[model samples]
Target: MDWDKLRIFHAVADAGSLTHAGDTLHLSQSAVSRQIRALEESLNTTLFHRHARGLILTEQGELLFDATSAMSRRLDTAEARIRDSEEEVFGELRVTTTTGFGSLWLAPRLPALYKKYPDLKIDLMLEERVLDLPMREADVAIRMKEPSQADLIRRKLMSVHMRLYATPGYIAENGMPESLEQLSQHRLICQNVQATQVSAGAELVRELLTYDVRSTLTVNNYFGVLQATRSGLGIGVLPDYVVEDFPDIQRVLPEVESKEVPVFLAYPEELRQSRRISAFRDFVTEEIIAHRKKMRQESESGA
Candidate 1:
């Protein structure tokens, strides 16, 4: 019933130490300990199991901690919403995306974004794992495929394909392959078939392996594959998005490529009106448009 006791209990449970919680709350250890005791007495249940090392949450404490954690996330979301301004976009925006795309594409363009919104704090989480948007694990995601999660405001950004690429140096060292049959002479650099990635990319790599290829190198993500390929390690199968920024890497086997993969941007439906979300969404859209225009120009000029 006492909000102050609940607050202290949450802090202690989070820190797993009364002294640490006291330090955070700017209260003495004795004061924090007394508050915990009072809360336990009021609830008539043990919230923590005291130990010499620190404190462990009891079953009751685990339940309460879960509730408090959810509350904390909700409060954070509320704070973000309150900070959203019509005239300015400034707040923490947790953005999640595949490591390859995040490092190769998004991260490079972030300087411009920071220049526009000097106060924005972007926590860029680069991993393949899909974070829970509704639960506030992350605020937005730009994924290789459409997100299937519920309660998300999804937008299709673009499509990409797994195509063979090799630096001119690599091609000079290992003679260019004229066809699928000729690929046997060169090493293949790509994501492992079992790695978490787009199925089309894995399928293309599998098909390439069917050839009489002798040397091969497999990385867990496209970023590593790109690096290896750029280093003249071998020919790499990478997403088409790289061609614009990495002009020195030439596309190989014009006739050979994987099925197209759709890219999507998604955020919680609750963030549909958020100014930060709008700013990010518009920024990405504008960038994609510019990329598309450049790609078209390159294609036209090459043709």
Candidate 2:
């Protein structure tokens, strides 16, 4: 019934030790124990099973702990939103994206963002797993496809295609493949078809495999594939965006490409007004524009 008692119980359940919880809460063990006892008496239930090593939550304690955890997350969301209302775009902004894009593309452009907002703290989570933005798993996400989750504000950033590439030395040494049939002569570097990659990329790799490539090197992520290609290991199936940063890697079999994989930036509807989110979204949009311009200029010069 008492908010203070609920808070104490939450901490104790989280730590599984009365003394440890007391240290975290800045209260003595006896004081914390008194609060837990008073709370249990008020609820008419035993919240934890006593043991010599540590305390274990009873069934009732588990239910209460679950409720408290939800409350804690909500409070965190509220705190972040409140901080966002301030004038400065400063504080931790958790961003999630695929390892390939995060490392190869986004990470390279982060300096400009830091220059503009030096006070901002970024926590970059690079993985294939899609975080739950609405549930606050991450504050923002840049995904290979449009998010299917409900209550998200999604924006399409750009589209990418998987294309073959190789180092000039590798091409000179092994010769280039001019057609699908000729591709079989060289080793293929790519993400394994079974790995967690965009459907379009996986499909391209599958089609490439059918060419009966003489040898293959499959990595779980595009970063690994890029590294191998850079090292002159073999022709690699990689996203066209990679060419922006790695101009030295020549595109092989230009006509051989995959279906378009749309990239999207998404955030929770509740964070629509967050200044931190706005700053990050605008920064990425600007970078995309600049990237497109640079590529176009190179194309015109070559033409």
Candidate 3:
């Protein structure tokens, strides 16, 4: 039950070699061995099966090692939390979102955040996979739909629609499709109906596919679709938000669009007071405001 013995046992079990554990702990091999022995004797169990190469944990040892490992990790996290500056917004913040949004929208706006919090470290995890914010898989998430996970503080950010777009060159060459029926004449670029994407987007792609488009380029993510569309590949089914960044691409088939897909920002309820989370939340809020303003101005100018 001694803490020191448990610590030595964890190091030894992790390394599986007494000399290696000793070297890591800055203790002699005999001393490390004594600690392990005393711990095993106290628990009345054979903690290890020793061989010439090293040691393997017995079932009992495995159980004890699991406990010690958890303890060690918790302690390390505690130490890190303690080391954080309570008054400053600084530390690693793991942010997760779909690749399309991260790369097209959020990633481009990060320089302002970096300017404000030069010390802050941001790990941007861009994927379709929804990371668990409550379990700390990621510190924050900006998702296409509201996260239904428990114990999360969620905020509605905006709504986006899946609309058809094509580069000027492509439209000029192929002639723009004026109606849904006419869309079938041009190659459609979009996310595969079965690919991991927002349901609304997939549904839009499915509906478009039903029009019997003769040729298609289906990418897994909107980023890929956008790149193909930019290259004058075909008419791309993409989120309306992308138009804010890519102004040259004109919308096609004005009546053909998906229902609005709501976007949400979520974080763990337990992180309500985390300074890093607050800073990031505020920064994103500001960016969203600016983005909306820019879009409004563009809309007005075009009108």
Candidate 4:
């Protein structure tokens, strides 16, 4: 069987349609269909069943897909190894991170990295969603949550401490809660994502806010919650690093403590040995470690 034809068939099977696969592979839909047809003919078995939605994989196709997926990954890893052996840091480094951190921190520091390695090109994808690194969605990922995947390489970069904060105006108008028990009297801004997750920060909020806590406003993004808190809408529990720079917001109930959320850096196991990846990994690790103390100080000083 032609390797190219097998590759095309695999792409189509994974994408669920000829047009989608063609778009991904930068080939014409007809060419992709022809390749799949040729592969099926050579193998003397029907690979896909035609359906209204798209092509559904047959039994043979499913088995082929499983093997082909592994084979493709190995081939890609080998290619990466070969390129790295040439000592060139001149390839695309796809990075995935959350919006708040990417905007406030990582994006600003990228220029220094580029200055050091002019040949390296970076594709920064910032979103709240964690992109799958093992599936080649991103080369490296910086996430707020620890990765539970056993296949990938994961490292804890730092612990992010969160605190309850409110605008001075809101606190003055609503009467500041003297203790954790009085928290329910004031309006509260809740983050939907954080509320749904049982993190240390979430647990602390639940424990402290015993009074009829009003969750009038809900937002998915931390930045939105920060803005709401800054606008004097309500008090919100936010990362200290995120809210420290907002002059209008004041930390409330500093005694009401919560757990620290550990930030993690993750990447695929295959790319661990690549020179460029290793270089970047080392550089980022050093930078974060060196700045960890400063981050903590900034949080404490509300800088």
User: Which candidate number would show the highest TM-score if scored against the true structure?
Assistant: 1
Highest lDDT model number: 2
Compared with the true structure, what per-residue lDDT tens digits does model 4 show for residues 165-273? 9989998898788876677677777565454442765676566556667555776656777888889988887777654346578888887656877888889999877
Q: Write the per-residue lDDT of candidate 3 for residues 1-303, one digit (tens) a residue.
A: 899898999999999999999999999999999998888889999999999999999999999899999999999987876776576677789999999999999999899898998889999999999888878999999999989999999998888999999999999999988788887899999988899988888898888888899999999888999999999999999999899889889999878899889999999999999888999999888888887898899889988
Candidate 3, clashing residue pairs?
A: none
The estimated TM-scores of all candidates read 0.73, 0.73, 0.72, 0.60
lDDT of 1 by residue, 122-178 (tens): 999999998999999999999988888899999999999999999999888878899
**Candidate that beats the other on TM-score, 3 or 4, i.e. the better one:** 3
Ranking by lDDT: 2, 1, 3, 4
lDDT of 2 by residue, 1-303 (tens): 899999999999999999999999999999999999999999999999999999999999999999999998999988986766576788899999999999999999999999998889999999999999989999999999999999999999998999999999999999988899888899999998999999999999899889889999999999999999999999999999999899889999988899999999999999998888999999999999998998889889988
Score candidate 4 by lDDT. Answer: 0.79
